[model samples]
Target: MLYFCPASVRVRAASGAALKPIQSINAHPSNCICIKFDPTGKYFATGSADALVSLWDVEELVCVRCFSRLDWPVRTLSFSHDGKMLASASEDHFIDIAEVETGEKLWEVQCDSPTFTVAWHPKRPLLAYACDDKEGKYDNNREAGTVKLFGLPNDS
Candidate 1:
């Protein structure tokens, strides 16, 4: 997998041996927060404080797509095992799932608290999400959270 550091958005490759730079693309000037790679290692995803997640074609070394208009900085992004969906979460308390090929938005879900993280279930059509939990006026304790379970609709 490859990653871009916060200070330097220069791309580098990391394997079992040593860190070798593959290439560098000026993604964002500052705050290159998070980076994710597709399972097959064909492409990569990058999220920045610029409120944008840019997709790159690793082989071609060109920018593929950019997703912006996020309510806040994009914190995380992940690709499904089959590489059909690209999931993104921001400090906006919402999640956007986009199609890998067409870059079309599959759906968006909202929660009260910001989605800190998300993972696709290993064996089922389910997603696990974690977020901050607020109790009451005197108590503002943060906690791990959950989202609604999504499954194929049943036909009668």
Candidate 2:
């Protein structure tokens, strides 16, 4: 069971047992924007308003890695189906993939529009990301969105 505390505080479980928290590490300057646990439940990643993404160990309860941003705040994060990669989306309108162990960015896709969400395929390596586009300068026309599929190359 993974949890996200906006202020980086460790939360107690519902069993009335207090879990020991490791030294607190601040991942983002602001509250966490989003968080997701890997399918295996071994680790979790956090997206933040400070434009950074952080990976934490579930068992150790300590942050293992942080990916800083240049200008955009990270809004969403997801792990690949196989848990080898991480995908992060931000207000910068781009989605980025990174190596889970090293926090090394592998690739990025620019949406050229505002993005709101990102998720991985349950059984495939494909990613589904959502973005919004305007039809006209004054058209405040916000329509239901779609998840644009982004493909990943074979790891081998």
Candidate 3:
């Protein structure tokens, strides 16, 4: 396979050879800001500065699909424990929960400011995310940043 960085990061094999990705992403110029690999390591997700989330196949090193509903540069990504879903966070004031296989947005969580980080419960469907107050833009009394959990089971 042709090995080149192409302005985007690449996956390097144990032998130090770069396995080329078959994606011609326009976001390469802007570059990816966050990335997450599924539990099985069969696939991975990349969140780009161009506001696109792309899923890549591990075997072929190809981009299988793209999710582009967010309007701002992506900041973070998380794969559900089971690898059935992905949470992509951005400064657009919302987080998108997408189905990994189809790239369909299953749900969204609105925010008061820029959300910079997100993660999933390793043993549950619970999702947690962190956001800033935009330097106390909405509430000067509030902290500079905060983290909240969503989808917590009542039993927990």
* Predicted structure with the largest lDDT when compared to the true one: 3
Comparing candidate 1 with candidate 3, which one achieves the higher TM-score? 1
Write down the lDDT of every candidate, Cα atoms only. 0.72, 0.73, 0.78
Q: Is candidate 1 or candidate 3 better by lDDT?
A: 3
- How well does candidate 3 match the true structure in TM-score terms? 0.79
**CA-RMSD of model 1:** 3.5
Where does candidate 3 have its weakest 10-residue lDDT segment?
11-20
Model 1's alpha-carbon lDDT is 0.72
Superposed by TM-score, candidate 1 places the C-alpha of residue 110 at a distance from the truth, in angstroms, of 1.3
C-alpha lDDT of candidate 3 relative to the true structure: 0.78
User: Which prediction has the highest TM-score against the true structure?
Assistant: 1
lDDT of 3 by residue, 84-131 (tens): 999998888889999998888788988888899999999999998988
TM-score per candidate, in order? 0.80, 0.79, 0.79
TM-score of 2: 0.79
Clashes of each: 0, 0, 0
Q: Is candidate 1 or candidate 2 better by TM-score?
A: 1
What lDDT tens digits, residue by residue, belong to model 1 across residues 1-156?
566677776566555556666555687765878888777677888888888888888887677898774768888887877667788888786788888788888777666677767776655545567665554222465553444443346411
Model 3 clash pairs?
A: none
